[model samples]
Target: MQVVIEKRGASLKVKDGQLIIKHGDQVQALAFNTIDSIVLSKATVLTAEVVAQAVEHQIDLLFVARGGKPFARLWSPYFGSIATIRRHQLLFSRSPEAVAWMKNVLTRKMENQQALLYALAMPNHATDKIIESAVLKIEEDKQRLQQIEGAKLADLSPRLRAVEGQATRRYFQAVNIHLPEMYRFGQRSRRPALDMTNAMLNYAYGMLYGRMESALIKAGLDPMIGFMHREEYNRPVLTYDCIELFRTWADWVVFDLCRQQVIFREFFEVEAGGYWLAHPAKRILIQHLTDFFEDQIEWEGLTRSRYTHMSLFAQRLAALLKEYKTDKNKK
Candidate 1:
């Protein structure tokens, strides 16, 4: 079984170690052990006992704020996962090998970004031109990064920031061109996505982020610690960083759905420069996004669902961190 998400207007209760979900007039119960993550789309009435039980079972509870934004998450520790702490320490140790590993990680991220751009550019020559420009910007950022001294981490940071902004702009431009005018925003801004399509996409993005956060926690990584994204006061910077690697996947899913006409433009509205998805549209988009993630996708010599691939990637990262710590201890 995979992750389980419960929407609003639904109630969940723990009875004899089983989770009973009540939706409308129907009720379904499942063993709590079978559950991985629970998403609360809106207000939920969960008991303190149930919360405690979920924590004991290491089940992640994710809460979505207004406009379907994931603003808070709660997770329990795995019994024997302490390597993430060690990895954090290694990252701060400032050793040559640590720096090398960080560089490798960043290189992989760049490669993934390139792959996504290639996919987006496949549809048209004009789009290809835009993607090529973005690619050049990425390359320039990489070159600048290589020339930066270790003492100038702050200087290298801005290059990465510029590259990310360029990449996102390229992506959004392609996306906006394909989408209805209602979904287009001249600049990236939070809240009130400009139309139904944007609202649905934003909600889907939130869901994906919550799932990635749970995966990170399960792998024992500190969701707040990160390299590409700075450690903000309370933001889960690591989750934000890792999400950058996979957000293109979500974008592609939404884009394809829009192209296929599987979703309707009438399902969304624009108000106050923000987009809103009707409840029905939200339901359909969520299900479509969920299925897309669960569908099998080939990666790294294995055929695994995107969801599984994400989990495995987090685990691999954790293992790499452990190896780094072991080498440090030996030295």
Candidate 2:
């Protein structure tokens, strides 16, 4: 994988054939071909041209925003995958079978979330109970959703929002349990994460979000469309919805590694009311996450690696959407 490691806080630009990285008065050049993901930890200078080049090459660009939140993301237009578009359109068309299939998929997703949360809250039974309660709430929501008949879209909206909020609350609570004491949150905090662990979580989550965005696009699902999440400005709603299923698993892996000291604290620092991972730690986290993706996972009586499973899931979602479109065309 092409890796662009940004070590200093500086401005970044792409001119001619080189990536111009500037920190204060110093500037360094890296060839475009040598970089896969452009990781900005504490880098200061970045230009539109740099982003454009990275997008053109389908390079995964990651930003470590304040709070050590690492965001692995790419612009929507450049990274658009044809397969994802087709699948998304297929799924969006409302149909009986389509809705049923979506329900089943979402149910499976919740099951996975429950399992991951249980694992993450090890030695703490409270987390498992919370997940169990969320499961019940999901059931209630599913029933309410199915019962909607000529129901105003507005009314249905609030119900779905309630269910989503409950589920999210449970998930976030579990996430906080794994965080460092300094970064443990009482409520939602944005931008700069307060401690090293939270910073890593933010950055790691960004990377995962980008990957999920790619997957949704490949599945032909509109990233901005969602079932459990409301449409919001500048947010890929569907990506957030689907990510709920897998985020816990990813978080578990990273937290475990951190707790084991596999990723040392020396690779990070506390600054400006937030934490930042050093260049070396960022590299290690990315490498380890890559490994985590390659590691095998068990689902639905089959054992397959996460990378393989993700690809397969995208294909399956695409196929389901195609079926929906076909039936619609017949009608």
Candidate 3:
């Protein structure tokens, strides 16, 4: 599983080949094999031995700032799969197969959104109309997505984004209906979230992004080389592409927290810039999100944890890309 070191002044060390974490009076030791990743979110001390052992055992070290945004990641340079996978990945970005993959990913995302709305809809309620309308809009966009013909992502990017953008607006419009008035938002905001809901959602999405990037890297895929997303300097565009499939997962977790009223204004710190989650709010979001990801769900006709589903998809995509005989590499 994942070990989150979020407590201020926490420190990690290696003792007898086991991972030792100490914060205040609490101390815990974890076996190296049992730990998948370590997320450092607050002031934490670690020795060189700890980093070496983590890399030796293939454990990832992800660092995040106060707003839950991942700023850096550490892993062994020798961990990526054979260079053949990445060779094909670059060619795959412009191929017809890439177009198909993009369409499939987006449609699946829209399908998940509709499923969420359907699950939330109930009988004899004014909100049912709102939810139903949102589902219809998303479905219409999904149909439009399927009808679009393109040889490559360039041919499809703009129209695809338009449909996805419209559908997302409708989806969030319905989602905001469920939020308490104090937490409801007019639009999605980032950088500095203007409302409590936006702040929580942004933080949760950031956490998801870090996990998804780690998964892609472990599968021997290059997170910077994207199929549908535009390439930019020093950006993990592939993570952005793959994250579409799982955004709803983060949305579900945050929505549940909001509905439960477990989050309050006091949990947030309002700044001249906007709003940020206090340390307590961050802890609550992390706990709930970690638990939600570990919960088993029906995926690909089998029961698997949501975290496993992402890793499996990354591995499968890497395998599939390796099999493709790109035009440049063809005999």
Candidate 4:
């Protein structure tokens, strides 16, 4: 379980081996061992004692944007995994192997998008013209990706991104149609979303981002070093790179909510940033995603929960890097 403090003026600190949270006239205490991470939402004030406890208890502290987009994080300086993996990660960033890995990542991403659109278009009651066209666009983009041949990061990244951008536009256009008229945001917008749909999508991605960061940390890999995306100051580049592979899943959850009519226009409020979910509605989206993550899915000839598959995928990624490093050293 994670501890989340979203109330403004809430003060958090370690008190006698428990997390002491005081907000307004209320107070709560949560045991450190039972906590996985601490998420402080907008305007929550944390004290130094809380940081020290987090480090000692191997907990991560995630600070999110007001509407729940991932903004920053804090964790222990010492990693649970070996230093060699990080060394290999930096070396792997520019290797030919990085390009090959990206090939698998992008292929899976596009295929998943196409699959989602096709699945939605199949039923007579569910037949969607926009989704069918989006599937065709994604397929074309996938073909373009296959035509690109350079093994060098400098040559491949831009070519791959251009194809992805086209497919992404098509996908969102299709997704936008499924939302109700009040919720439809038309195109994807961020860093202060332009509409209700964009705001919901941003919040969903933020939740997924936190999960990815935790998975990478647990797998003993550095989330900062990455291939494809350039290193930016304080950005979790690898997290962004890895997330592309799973973005379809996140998109599906948000879109599915709209299809099921679980998220209506009434659940939102218009604010300075355009739109945000009412607190209760936000919690419902998260709870639904929690159920979705635990559902069974067929992957690699085995059925597994989405959450477990994600963890296994991260471990496999680390192993692939190790293999590449070992091969490079021998040559």
List the candidate 1 regions with Cα displacement exceeding 4 Å.
1-7, 15-17, 83-155, 180-185, 265-271, 325-330
> Residue-wise lDDT of candidate 1 within 1-331, one digit each (tens)?
4333445577778888778778789888888787777777665667676678778988888788656667786777553388655465336434444444455555566666666667656665666776777667767655654554463233355665665566556556655664545445565556866555566668777878888877878887777776555536778767776776677677777766666666666666567666666556777777777788889989888899998989998888777666664444565
Best-to-worst lDDT order: 3, 4, 1, 2
Rank the candidate models, highest TM-score first: 3, 4, 1, 2
For each candidate in turn, the TM-score is: 0.81, 0.64, 0.96, 0.86
Q: Which candidate number maximizes lDDT?
A: 3
For candidate 2, give the lDDT: 0.61
TM-score of 3: 0.96
Candidate 4 per-residue lDDT over residues 1-331, each given as its tens digit: 5666656688897788899899888989999888767888878888898898888888889887767766788888764477777888888887777887887798888888888777666455454767877888788898888888876765788888899888888877776766666667768888777776677778888887887877788788888887887546678878888988888787778877777777766777776757777776687777777688778999887799886788788888877666555454876
Give per-model CA RMSD: 3.5, 5.9, 1.4, 2.9
**In model 2, what is the error at residue 271, expressed in angstroms?**
4.5
Q: Tell me the deviation in Å of residue 228 in model 2.
A: 3.8
Q: Please give, for residues 132-176, the per-residue lDDT of candidate 3 as tens digits.
A: 888988889999988989788866888888888889999999989
- Residue-pair clashes per candidate: 7, 22, 0, 0
lDDT of each: 0.67, 0.61, 0.90, 0.78
Cα lDDT tens digits for candidate 2, 194-241? 655666677667766766666666455676665445446667766666
